[model samples]
Target: MNEPWNPYDVMPAARSADPAAAGARIDALPVSERWKRRFRLIAKAGGPRLPNLGALTFGERMAVMFSVLGLLFGPLYLLCKGLWRPALAYSLIIVAVGFAALMLGLEMLARGVGYGAAVLCANRACALYYRQRVLGERPWL
Candidate 1:
C-alpha cells in the first residue's frame, strides 16, 4: 500500500517558492472571505494563523462552537476550557446584572440583559480560545 501524500511535507518550501499559491490556498479556506482577510491581517500582526479552516482539529472546532452556544453553560464551558479568569468575570457580571435587575423590579429586562451578556461572553471566549489554541497566540480576553 502507498502512503497518502502529506501537504505539510511540501508546504514550507512551496509557500516560500510560490507566494501566489499560498494566497490562493488562503482564499480557498472554508470560512468567510472576511475571516480569511482577518486571518491574513492577524498573520501580519505577528500572530499565528491557520492555512485553512480545515486545519482546525475537531476538538478545537467543537470548543469554539460550544463556546458560541454557551449561554446556559458559559461559566462551565470556559472553566473546562481552562479559562478561569474569563469564567469568573462572566459569572460576576451575570450575578451583578441579576441583582441589579431584581432591585429595580425589572426581571424581564434583567433576563434579556443576561442573555445578551451570555452571548457576548461566549463570542469573546470563542475568539480567545481560537487565538490561544489554534493560532498559537497568547490569550488576551
Candidate 2:
C-alpha cells in the first residue's frame, strides 16, 4: 500500500522566503476579528464571564443540582420495604455522602476555573507589559 501524501510535511519550514503569502494572510483580516471570534464563542457558551458558584451557565447549575438530588435517592429503589428508622438513617447517610462528594466536586471545579482565569489574566498582563515596555504603552488590552 502507498503512503498518503501530507501537505504539511511537504510545506516549507519558513515563510520569509514567501513574504507575499505571509502579507496576504495578515492583510486578509481586520485586527479586531480575533477578539470578535473569541467574544462570539463566549456568548455561544452562555456568557463571557465565569460564575463564582462553579456553574458556567444556568443550565449547568440546574443539571448539577438535579444530579445530586438523584444520586441521593436513586439507590433507595432497590432496597426492600423497611421501617422509618432504617429508611431515615439510610436517607441521611446517602444525603450526607452525596453532599460531601458534591462539595469536593464543586471545590475542584472552582479551583480549575480559578486556575484557568489566572492563566488567561497572566498572559494578558504579560502581553500588556511587553507592549508598554517596547511600544510606549498604546493601551494594548
Compare the candidates by TM-score and give the number of the best one: 1
Candidate 2 lDDT over 9-99, as tens digits, reads: 3322322212233334333323355433332322233332212325335654332222232233332321221122333454465456556
lDDT of each: 0.54, 0.33
**lDDT (0-100) at residue 131 of candidate 2?**
25
lDDT of 1 by residue, 15-132 (tens): 2212343355545545565445544443333333334445555764444333544566767777775566667787888789889998999989888877777776665665554354
In candidate 2 the C-alpha lDDT for residue 100 amounts to 71
- In terms of lDDT, the best-performing candidate is 1
Candidate 1, TM-score vs. the true structure? 0.48
For residue 49, give model 1's deviation from the true position in Å. 13
| Residues forming the 10-long window of minimal summed lDDT in candidate 1 | 8-17
In candidate 1, residue 39 scores what lDDT? 45
Residue 1, candidate 1: Cα error in Å is 30
Off by over 4 Å in 1: 1-69, 134-140
